[model samples]
Structures are given as structure tokens and as C-alpha cells.
Target: MSDTLEILLTNDDGIDSVGIRAIHDALVEHANANVTVVAPASDQSACGRSISHGGEIGLVDHELGYAVEGTPADCVVAGLAELGPDPDLVVAGCNRGANLGEYVLGRSGTISAAVEAAFFDVPAIATSMYVPVDETPLREIDLSTDDFREARRVTTYLAEYALDAGVFDHAAYLNVNVPTPGKRPAPIEITRPSKRYEMDAEATDGSVTLHDRVWESMDPETIPDPDGTDRRAVAEGRISISPLTAPHSTNHHETLTELAETYHDRVATADD
Candidate 1:
């Protein structure tokens, strides 16, 4: 790694979003990084790792970087394979909302971008801020670059030093979630993704409405996540950094082995 970093910066939010711009400026101005922004042209949040397979992915030159007509994952694939220089690191987001649970790991476009980079043997970081639900609806809440001050501070620190610190030696990528800044700055904490799952569906008039009940319980007092979990850390006004691997890990099972061994015998017996 050189003193100056070559970074591929992207996000699930559109390139015009404040969060992406905040992070992009932070890395370049603070981390002394040369950043190439290859982000979605439109909001692609929660699109996960879905790519435009066998389809054309359009790219437009923007003042900041390239605006990709695809998902967050596609931005990374394009950045690493074609659009940008071979980056030392790939960063996805300063996303609008928090992605803090195990269930969200496979569903968040912000995190999926980082996961895509890991497959290319590059270190990556996925960042998001936990927005508190208030009387103002989430969609109506307007956030500015000021809202991302803490996120930018933390992300820039890591980007500047984490590589030389060997933070990525064991972890394929990092999932970082920052709490909305308060009167005092939030402290950073290492954490694991929470396992709590609370999804419900209501069916009426031949339509089903899916609800993720977890958001309602994110209050510090009501959150059921343990102290060391990402959701809990964020709810308690701390930055949560969860080191994670990209690949799906499988455990060896004797029962599955035995089942495989009996497969031909069972088929023959059924035929007989």
C-alpha cells in the first residue's frame, strides 16, 4: 500500500445524494485519497447484489465520477473490471438508513457493493447512518452534509489507516453503521450483526403488505439486541463496526454425507 490511497467510492443512493458527496469529499480532502465515484444514477437502495446480467450497463460522466445505470453491486463490478482504475479500496455508502442486522446483510445494496468487491480480492467498507424515526416520516426527513459529519470522520480515519493496520487480513470487508450525531459525538464500538428478526405480513383484498417490525423497536430502551450487537450499539449512540467475510460459509454435516451415500440405494429400492 502506498501513502496515497486509490479508492473506488460508491453508494446505493443516487450520485446526487448528500451522503455520497459527503463521503467522497471526506476521503479526498481528509484521507488524501484519489477517489473514483461509480455510483447508481438513481436510488437503488435494498436492491442487494442483483446485477444487470447479460444486459447493457450505461455510464455517464459526472463532475464527481461516473453515474452508473445499474445497482450498487453493478457499480462495483464496473469500477473494478472496467470503469475505474484498480482501487486499493472500495467504499459503499454513507447510506441514508442503517443496515445493522444479519438479515439485512444479504439485502442491503450498500453492503452488497462491498461484498462484490471482496470477490475481486479488494478490501471494502460499507457505511450507513441510523436515522431515528420521529413525527416526521422517514421519507420526508431532509438530511444535509452536516448530518454525515460523524460518519465522514470515522470512515476517513479507517480509510487512512485500516489497511496498514492489517484490519482486512481476516475480514473480507467491514460493515460500519453510525448513529445520527447528537450534542456530543458518538464513540465507536466493535460489534457483530444482531440476530433478531421481526418480519410480519398482513394480507387484505388479495394484497400482502410486508412489515419489518424491527425498525419500530430501535429505541434504546426497547431494542432487544444485546450490548455487543450492531443495532444495540447504534441505538445507544455509538458507531458500530462489524468486520465480516463475504462468502457464504458452510459447515460439514455427517447427516448430509449419510444421505448422499444412501441416495442411489433409496432410488433403486423405490424403483423395485
Candidate 2:
């Protein structure tokens, strides 16, 4: 716990992206916390912690600071282990889109970066903005960069209050999403990741089309998610913050263990 916040900033969107720049700017406004950005030189969305094998990682001098040539997780790994002092907190986004629901999380590089940090016993946050379809350009979304004021609002507030207040003590990391303000009736709710998405993938003549059905694209009137779920809260135009823990083991049943032991002993004795 340094006296001041030392932050390691990163994103799935490449270092030159607008979203990362906006976030870095907002964090720099804090006179106390120092922000150092070490992120992928190129966009690695949905790559999900996949590291390059012996690839070149060099310093990229940006207007903000140095950017690395690797995945989002690579940036965090390099920053903590090599580049800067271990950050007080790792913030992974202000991503181009919401990373709500279990399915989305498993596929999102932004969330994966935060998850990687949690493995090191460091608290992290993954933030995103919801942009309705057709409103954004295919080029930029392809480039994977955007900054909504509401997304920044939630991220700034969380960054300021979350650490010192010990909110992260309970959760390994937070996954936050700001609903597009265009959606009517905004309300913020503490929520859980919804695990409701089905994949419809098909292969055509030398091509593949993977359709991702996100409920955020649907009208709030049609979503079947219960209250307090991350998807539901965002659909309602609220900033959704989900407290998440990475990779945990469930307790094994004593009776089952005992039975397994007994069976194993009998089999061993019989073999002897």
C-alpha cells in the first residue's frame, strides 16, 4: 500500500485507442495517484490472455507514456513484473462495449486482463460502455475504441472510492458497464453476471459466421433477466458494477472422498 495510488492502465483496445487515452486523462486528474500505461500496441479484443510466444515487446512512446507490443494481459504482466512498480490497482478498460454476462466475459480480452491481475492478489476493475448497434462506425468498433461520458463517470468514481474504502476486499475484481444514455430510464444496480447467451455458428464456403446474441441490443421490455443481474441493470441505463472473483475451487464432499478412498484401497489390495 503506497501512500499514493500507483495505477497500471491497460485495455483490449490498442494503446493508441481513444478509450484508453480518455481513461488515462481522467485518472491523471488525480493529483495523488500516478498513472502509467503499459498496454498492447494493437487491439487484442476477445484474445483472452493469450500470450505471444517469444514475440518482440518494445517500448512505444505515446503522448501518455510507453505502450508494449503484446496482449492486454501481457501489458499487465510486463508492467507488474518488469516496467513500473506493481500498481496499487489494475484498470482494464473503458472498453468499446459492455462485457456483461458469463459468455461475454469468457470471450473478452478486457475482462481477461482484470482476471489475470486478480491471480496475482491485486484488485482490478474492467469497465465498458454500451453503444447501440448502427450508432457506431464499423471502422472504429473494428478499431475498438470509444469513450462515453457515463462510462468515464462510473470508472472515475470507482477508481477514487473503491480502493481506500476497501470495496475490493470483498471482490477480486469489478466488471462495470455504463448503459448507452440513449436508452430511456436510467437506474444503477449492483448486479451479478448473467449466464444467458447461446452461440449460433456456421461454416460456409471457406468462411465462418459467428453470431453473438447480446441482450443489450434488445429493448429493455423484452429482456427476461431478473433484477440485480449485470445485464438487467445496464439495459435499464444504469452503470452496472459486478463484483467478481476469479477461478475458485469448490469444496469436495467428505462422503465422496471417503468412498473413493475405500474403493481405491480395495482395488489396490485385490491387485496385490
Deviation in angstroms for 271 in model 2? 10
Winning model by TM-score: 1
**Residue 126 Cα positional deviation in candidate 2, in Å, after optimal superposition:** 0.8
TM-score of each: 0.97, 0.86
The total number of steric clashes, by the backbone 3 Å criterion, in model 1 comes to 0
**Tens digits of per-residue lDDT for model 1, 1-272:** 77889999999988999999999999999999999999999999899999998868888999999999999989998899998888999999999989999999999999999999999999999999988886777757899999999899989999998999999998999999999887676899999999999999999998999998899867788778988999999998899999999787899999999999999999999999
Worst window of 10 by summed lDDT in candidate 2: 138-147
**Shift of residue 264 alpha carbon in model 1, Å:** 1.0
For model 1, the superposed segments whose C-alpha errors exceed 4 Å read none
Task: For each of the candidates, give the backbone clash count.
Answer: 0, 0
Q: For candidate 2, lDDT tens digit of each residue in 8-108?
A: 88999788777887788777775256988888888888898787677677777876767777888888888888888878899887788778888788778
Give me the overall lDDT of model 2.
0.79
